[model samples]
Target: MTMSISVNARAWMAAGLVLVMAQASISFAQNSKDPIPPKAPAYFPSVANQYVVRLNHEVPALRTSKAFSGIEDRLGASIKEVLRPDLVLIERRNKETRTSALVSLRKNREVAYADPNYIFQALKAPNDVDYSKLWGMSNVGAMVSTKRGLKGVDISAERAWERTTGSKNVIVAVIDTGIDFTIPDLAPNAWTNEKELGGVAGVDDDGNGYVDDIHGYDFVNNDGDPTDDQGHGSHCAGTIGARGDDGLGVAG
Candidate 1:
């Protein structure tokens, strides 16, 4: 007897086989243990700008001379009355002993006490503290805006420097974020001619009509010593005036 077979019989047979294989694979997978859920991403803590008070004086001899207990008691009493619950007391000694009492103040208090001049005088008496000496000053740490890496010299400033390594007399005002003058690369560029002009505040000393513009002015805050708080201006400054030939980031 003659048998009639469909032209697509082979295709249909192949499809059935494939479907059976797929179902078997799915069943096997389902019988296996469930995959472990991906671990949650790690959390990064945010940094807040807090005021630091650096005492110019060395640590008091009294701290180790059995007098600390009384001071601590007095401090505890005073703190209960007026200090913030988060206040911190720290003592440090290097070439000199020093103490720092830190308290987080409200925005109004910060504004009232953010005077760099006052902070400078408080830390360095007679001669104003140079940027190089900022680390030594009392009640001074990294300013909120100046916590980032130091501002770099910009290309234009480099060309300016090529023309003049900066006349120990010429002062360039960085008007953006406060400068990180402490950086070794930019240290030389920091304005050092304190004798030429006083730092910018509200008082103009050289009759330049701009007060305290000793180094440069911060148009953002209307003050002098336009150090970068953010680092854009610093980067620009780096491009313009960073010491070239130094094995670091792209040179100016």
Candidate 2:
């Protein structure tokens, strides 16, 4: 009887151990499938009807690059513009690194050319907060887009706010078309080179080659307004900085 009792006790203990390990494995598997979170606090500004593609480093420079020409031939759409990846301010891109090229495919062709070469890694966007209502000033534990209804469940912006909201000293130049400095929300935070605005009106006050650049210079029109006729510059400016805590539009 004693021997039987001892054997039964050992068997029960072994059975419990197995059950515990099985439960742990199931929990691990569920966690492993969790989505990767987004790194940026704001939505990646949308690139409309456009996809930026990169060539292998072995490819030549963009202007006369054979790879660029070949991609255009394959896509039936010419490269709209050559995009030079800016040398990272803190660390320059590798000398062997090649630049990215922009391409626009007809809506129908977008789906067809998405081959192994076209897509390197899957793109992920955050989707858990009520961004439209959030105003971007408040911390977003999980920001979800109301219009799109996609899901980026684990993104966090609380830690970034803890460190800094922003500083006025920093100048974020909108190098695209131009910014609408007159926009009420942005006007308060617009970057004016007071040094230039303070000087004589038509006389290249700051000697930066453009005259009277009180707000920002426009490369497209050769003017100072940067009023954003195409609306691209204004949209970009709003994303870069839109006056935090102003109770008007989105925050930077």
Candidate with top lDDT is 2
The residue-by-residue lDDT of candidate 2 on 160-200, one tens digit each, is: 33334455555666666566666764677676777777998
Candidate 1 structure quality by residue, lDDT tens digits, 1-252 = 111110111111011001101111000111113342232222311112222222212223443444434433433211111112222232212122111222222132311121010111011111212322223211234453656323332122222222223233333443455556655546655554353354444556567554565555666566555556777766545533444334433223
Task: Report the number of the highest-TM-score candidate.
Answer: 2
Error at 250, model 1, angstroms = 4.4
Using Cα atoms with residue i matched to residue i, what is each candidate's TM-score against the true structure?
0.29, 0.42
The residue ranges of model 2 lying beyond 4 angstroms of the native Cα positions read: 1-148, 153-158
Could you tell me how far off, in angstroms, the CA of residue 196 lies in candidate 2 after the best superposition? 1.9
